[model samples]
Target chain A: MNMSISEIEHEIIEEFGVFENWVDKYDYLIDLGKSIPKINPIYKTDENTISGCQSQVWLHAKCENSVIVFTADSDAIMTKGIVALLIRVLSNQKPEKILDAKLDFIAKIGLEEQLSQTRATGLSSMIKQMKIYAFAFKEKL
Target chain B: MSNKNNIQSLFPILKSSVNNNKLVYLDNAATTQKPNSVIAEINKFYLKENSNIHRGVHHLSQVATKKYENSRLVTQNFINARHSHEIIFTKGTTDSINLLASSFGQLLKKGDEIIISEMEHHSNMVPWQMCCERSGAKLKIIPCNKIGELDLDMFNQLISNKTKIVSVTHISNSLGTINPIRKIIEISHQKNVQVIIDGAQAAAHVKLDMQKLDADFYCFSAHKLYGPTGVGVLYGKENLLNLLPPYQGGGEMIKDVSLLKTTYADLPHKFEAGTPNIAGVIAFKKSLDFITETGLGNIKTHEDKLLDYATEKLNSIKGLKIIGTSSDKSAIISFIIQDIHHYDLGLLLDKMGVAIRTGHHCTQPIMKKFKISGTSRISFAYYNTIEEIDHLILAINKAIKMLS
Candidate 1:
């Protein structure tokens, strides 16, 4: 609950220095996806599926000590990587805090302008699903 | 003999020095490039004869109406339909399917069943899904084999007395498997079930004879057949269409509007409401003309060669896997390389000026059956040559090397 979001952002940016073009930036994003721990297979089922995505993605999150910790996986590797990036940015936070989080992290990472409309939509849907979880968790809290 | 040199010359895209580079367009499955003659006909419509059809008293309107009606007759002849009245102009194949589903689907009872195949595109599948959901009717699927061919025995076993509608694709866009539509129709008709054939993929490559096939409803998109977008044809037997209620209520589809009772227009007009895609409908004739000029047989021969050449080249690459190998396929070849993602491969291929379709191709059910996330598809048209296939092969080889 006391985690510094900006500190994590600074570390990510510092770890992968600013690149010349979007191509280099995408490699960094892909690397960001690779760094996250893989989601467990048991949590992946029909209940956790996203409707609009072309791939089968599953996400599981639990609140421990008032901190939201999330785990996600996908049948698609890149999509799994995408979910990992999403989990890094969105998870392990309170419901209100997660709901108020800025989605401009995509632009900060240089993916907003670089990714195609289809890929952007997929990312947007993942964010929406996370928000849905936040809203559901908010009521219980 | 049709020389390869002359055949290449026929396609202006191959010859035109655009941006000082030869355009290697491989997105033929999406929509094909139009010939100069077709372009001129469209231009002539806007320049010389441009007016509203059916309701106009002016000379230009008369010409436009004549052309529009003539296009219908031409399309009817092309598909060998019983009458021009059966050909209803729609926005696209999606619109045609939606219209049928909304109207005929409303007639289905709670326990009634509708059958579809696994190889259907989303347009064919989604409408039926919605239809069954709305009507409380059960939906059944005829499973496709690993080779992407339909299991005919499974199809026959699925047919029962409670089955009200049976819809299937004439050809698989992702697999290029040409289905046995006639046999399916016969099987469905035996149980008094109506058959709707989604001809979106088949219309471009194979010839259609609606009467011979005896399908109750046949739908296709004009854009898929080298014609303009925003226009398609829905062919239904006269009696069946009459039996089904009107889909949309609007102008031109009404016989009389009254406070007490309203009567609908007859035949195709009842299905077609309001002002249709006039320009797209008019230009579609030229596309059909182009096909007639080149001949469907000639077009099929050209595309088959390209498919063969591309398949052989792609197969030679190490670690590459080809999906959907049916003996009776058209011109679609879908594949993926081991350990390399399809999207990554597509991005690399595009940089080399080769366009290909990547991902599920709106056939998620088929993707689920294959147990893979997705595959990269290279679909061919009549104008495509072996040289482009070679370029595709080279680009794919380079892409795989970059990833590995």
Candidate 2:
């Protein structure tokens, strides 16, 4: 079954359980991070550094035979995972399609508001980075 | 040992877990976790003693005002200021430094110079940059050595009659370099230059007596010192603060409010501007109490041990290069692994329940100096243990293996 953002978020929220304890919350975050697709090491380079993030991130995308493929990595685990999720949702899709995709799709997963402000900002930077990459790739194509 | 147990007891954050692994919090330079006593003090203020400070004449207000003033006294004592009036409440170190820049910067003439160091946090650097840009003053940088320590010889060469201010950080957030501030202050004094120290990273671990340091001004955030985020201390010499115009014109900072003729309040109140972070300020004292009670010497010792332990372990790993290997480091270990991006390393470490800081650390110039984009930083606090260092070493090795 193909899982939508909402479905995945719901599953995560349900499985993540309570935040009465900080440990549980961190576990849920790490688990969520681990679920993202791992970016290949070859793509990690100077071209993908996002300004304002405490972690170093490299995002690489290509319109390989008209199927957009994104490869990314970060020095942070949660950020890495977050980028993975972004790639899953945005990568291998038409630049215009991905560009027009609503960011609310993330919130619908119930995961958007749940992250810390720093984490949220990091995710936003990643999304912005991806979109920039998409624009560059589209122009090249 | 007494200090260790007391400090551990105060901060329950030490006992917490991160992810599935034991939490190894090594990002102390960013901000420290609040102790239970401080947290309780904050809650108590909110729960029972909630009231507007200073202006209010009600019972609760009196209590709050008293408490707030008491906190001011505590801060004044902490920094060893001559008078509590020298201690102005601020949002944080950033706000206080900005306030000075905005007011005092307006007076700086063209060709004037404000000397800063290579190791300042963005909070300390940006305001001076803006001040120089606005006033046509020159921004002179005191360069750091390859080891990340400030070049005192370069500093001597840079400071001249034109040098109006020489601002620097007491302890670098990214490099963990502990600057020789007394010498810096002495040299600046010789040039008759005002000195503003960014003590945000130093306040918790360093012994700071403003009179002894002889700094014209000192700024530090409460959050970095295990206190609340919204309150900070700005200890300015009375003579200097009085000469500089108020940063923001508003209520509580003025005596008579007429658009035609507004007379400003005296000393600290003149700079305060508006209703301060009352609760945060009052509760902040408890954090100071926790720190004072712990004794900076003991804290330094504990943290040094942790830093040495972590450095030894991390250095042992192959292909690992420790960044900012200054002779004088304050519990911060910033490093990079060859053939692996800091992003990958940070992510893997988090999975292992280790929280570290990564990236350029807001000092792009320093990063450019090193010819690297960023490094992974694991800053230590007194609460962090040797065992946490062990965990971090293991995690780093594992992450390297996984990524490579």
* DockQ score for model 1: 0.20
DockQ of each: 0.20, 0.29
Best of the candidates, lDDT: 2
Clashes of 1: 1
lDDT of 1 by residue, B1-404 (tens): 25666766655666654223366677777777776666677788999998888888999999999999998999999999998999999999999999999997879889999999998899989998999889999999999999999999998888899899999999898888889898899888988999999999888898888888899999999888878789999999989988989999888889999988779999889988888888789889988988888889998988888888888888999988889998988889989789877866765566566778888888989998999878899898887778778778877887676555
Tell me how large the interface RMSD of candidate 2 is. 5.1
Cα lDDT, model 2, residue B41: 89
The local lDDT score (0 to 100) that residue A136 gets in candidate 1 is: 86
What's the CA error at residue B219 for candidate 2, in Å?
0.8
lDDT score of residue B17 within candidate 2: 75
Error of 1 at A14 (Å): 11
Q: Show where candidate 2 strays beyond 4 Å.
A: A1-141, B1-6
Each candidate: chain B TM-score: 0.96, 0.97
RMSD of each: 4.4, 5.5
